[model samples]
Target: MRQPMIDTYEEAIEAVRACGILPLAPLIPDHPSLSGITLPERWHSDTELDPWRWRVRFPGDGIAAYGKFMKKKAILVASDLVPSVRSLLGSSRSIAQRYGDGLISKAAKEVYAIIEEEQGIETRALRAAAGMKAKESKKEFDQALAELQSGFDIVISGVRAPRNEAGEVNGWNSTCFETVEHWMEGAGIPLAPMSADEARSRLQARLGEHSSPQAMAYFAKVFGF
Candidate 1:
């Protein structure tokens, strides 16, 4: 089911358009950045996925940064980078199984079953066991959180650039944070940072039971407060 690898950035863009996922990269003078960076006039396309929302993938560290960006967008497919077998049998699946069985919920199991069947391994007991174990671990939530944190850290550090002439970032710029904050505001998520006591009070009001101060602190820490 893997598509042929596209050699050029233009080909990749066309492929992404067909797949309905936006391709974005960081800005560079001689390179392309996906979000908010100006493009060469001749490179524009009429694709459904906006070029402005695409990312730049230069050589070296650019791939890492691009991966971080994709994670932020919730569209990074591990299967795209490595063989599906690697991703299916790797830490990603284990992590999914760890946090909550819900990570490998029924839908995921169905998908796995289909993949197994296609690979002629549907009756393989060992494969079945492995899938079940992954479900049991529920590690996906923690892994997903870790991935998000890394991307958030990258964004916050101003490392991925909409850079200046000397290659210095003009100011604190985070496309991912901006996108999330925008979404939250539109969804009516509160912008206020609550203190431990305040959060406890809010939780009590909502659930009729207060979370412990330690729990609130833990929540705050996890959420980057």
Candidate 2:
């Protein structure tokens, strides 16, 4: 992919939303090579201002954005906004897919979780798939982490969650799981029709624990086990 350029935060936000990806720009120390880049001087002097910290917006229909910051220059991300930006670029393909699988798996394990919680089948399935996808996503995430040859530091805030019409907890609004699920489904992975026994075994194996009671109820409602 080509390096994306933006003159302002708003432009970056718009671009990421359009592409169904999050935009992250963390601030780091100014390098000798960055002497001529046109950025605010305070970005170099202000401890609170991380030039590497960038705004991350989900695709259209998402509710919130995530802001990520790194102390070091990212190597995987390629951008003039910050040297070593190349290292910070991470993809959610596998993680998202894993989450989708997990959601389905968990729902199958405890059908009651879905029933009591009134959670939708699509929602539970997606979460499970994301967990499964993370296994692969982490591999790529690690690669991005290692590619950073030099800089300050890195911190992943958390997954971005969106809100419903009443401001209640809704589905994930980020591309992390969504992107992975899209690919998995496109590749012909079945995320539905999982059985309780199968779901429980897979959930226990993957999570190292049994499914939660609430999760079970939600699954019951969605999967009808």
Q: List, residue by residue over 1-225, the lDDT tens digit for candidate 1.
A: 123444355655544433222225432222222332334442445343333333322111112122343334423211122122111112333323533565434433443333333321222232344344365544643343335333321121111334578988665433322222222233344434435444444333322123345433533442333
| lDDT, candidate 2, 77-191, per-residue tens | 2111111121223222233353466522332223223222432223334344335345565554333322211211222222345667898878744322222123223334343
When summed lDDT is taken over every stretch of 10 residues in candidate 1, the lowest stretch is: 77-86
Instruction: Tell me, by lDDT, which candidate is best.
Output: 1
Q: Any runs in candidate 2 off by more than 4 Å, and if so which?
A: 1-29, 32-54, 58-127, 130-167, 170-225
lDDT of each: 0.32, 0.31
For each candidate in turn, the TM-score is: 0.23, 0.21
